[model samples]
Target: MSKFKYLIDGIVKNNPTFVLVLGMCPTLATTTSAVNGMGMGLATMAVLLCSNMVISLLAPVIPNKVRIPCYIVVIAAFVTVVQLVMQAYTPGLYETLGIFIPLIVVNCIVLGRAEAFANKHSVLESALDGLGIGIGFTLALTCIGLVREVLGNLSAFENKFSSSDGMLVFVLAPGAFLVLGYLMVLFNKLKDRKKKA
Candidate 1:
């Protein structure tokens, strides 16, 4: 049950993107398409997993004063690896993702988990935390991307399913914000209703 708490934290209570709303830059910018969303999510997931593992292993050795720096170094190392590997193998995605990929080093989601959860937890716990948070982030991004693509660009939903112009708001950058904001409001309302019932 304790392990599952990580899931709750990442998905509902402490989401890196929507709930806590960290990493807004990429959340707003890279979510123009489903492809870009997946690319960013996968890249971020890799960095989170590796950093969490490293932090868990070094939890004992990482000093209290220099803990932040140590966690960052570990996270940055994984981000660099993800950047290089993506550049070599998925040049198209790398190009599309652009500077956001490099920005993973500073992304609060990855570093936040490292410091708040991973460093204080056992290796298994840290790994689970990383996975949960990573998945939550990916899910949120994908939803945002889908809405943006379908509403901002008519081709987004139609291209995947049938052949018709759906709407253009889903593709534009402004549409992402609009959709996300509404979604957040809806989620909050739903949560409140559940609490009262």
Candidate 2:
């Protein structure tokens, strides 16, 4: 019941991307393609899950004055591990993501969860929170990336959709903002309708 609320909150009511609007850096920078978006999402999710668990375990031991710094150290350690693994196994995606991978160390979603949720909750709850938020973030990015890829590159899931004809702009930085803005508007409208119903 209440234990599961944290998970649902992250995915629906308090989504890191759509609702909370946290972690915009990677959301905007690494989502140039569907694959890139999924890659970035999973990488961030891994760090989020691990860090949240570890932070929860250490919360009682950490001093209040130095908690933030301690959280950063824990988060950075996980990010480093993820980075090395990505570089070793997924070299292409690793290269595509570039600095954004390491940038996850400072992602607001990670820090926010660490400080706001994990520090106050049990290990299982914190892990679930991280997983839910990570999934939400991943889904949002994947949707945006899928749309951009289809419109910008005329491709989806490695398959070409209309003979390589595309808007080109949809693949750029401005396009990310444009798509995200429209999606946000649409999402809000849907939520309003749901509430009314």
lDDT of 1 by residue, 119-180 (tens): 88898888888887888888888777877776656445236654666566666766778888
lDDT of 2 by residue, 106-169 (tens): 8999999998999999999999999999999999989888888888999996688688579999
Tell me the lDDT of model 2 at 36: 87
lDDT of 1 at 97: 89
CA lDDT scores, all candidates in order: 0.81, 0.92
Return the clash pairs for model 1, or none: 148-170, 148-171, 151-168, 151-169, 151-170, 152-168, 152-169, 152-170, 152-171, 153-171
Candidate 2 residue runs with Cα over 4 Å from true position: none
lDDT of 2: 0.92
Runs with alpha carbons beyond 4 Å of true place in candidate 1? 156-170
Clashes of 2: 0
- TM-score per candidate, chains pooled: 0.89, 0.98
Top-lDDT candidate index: 2
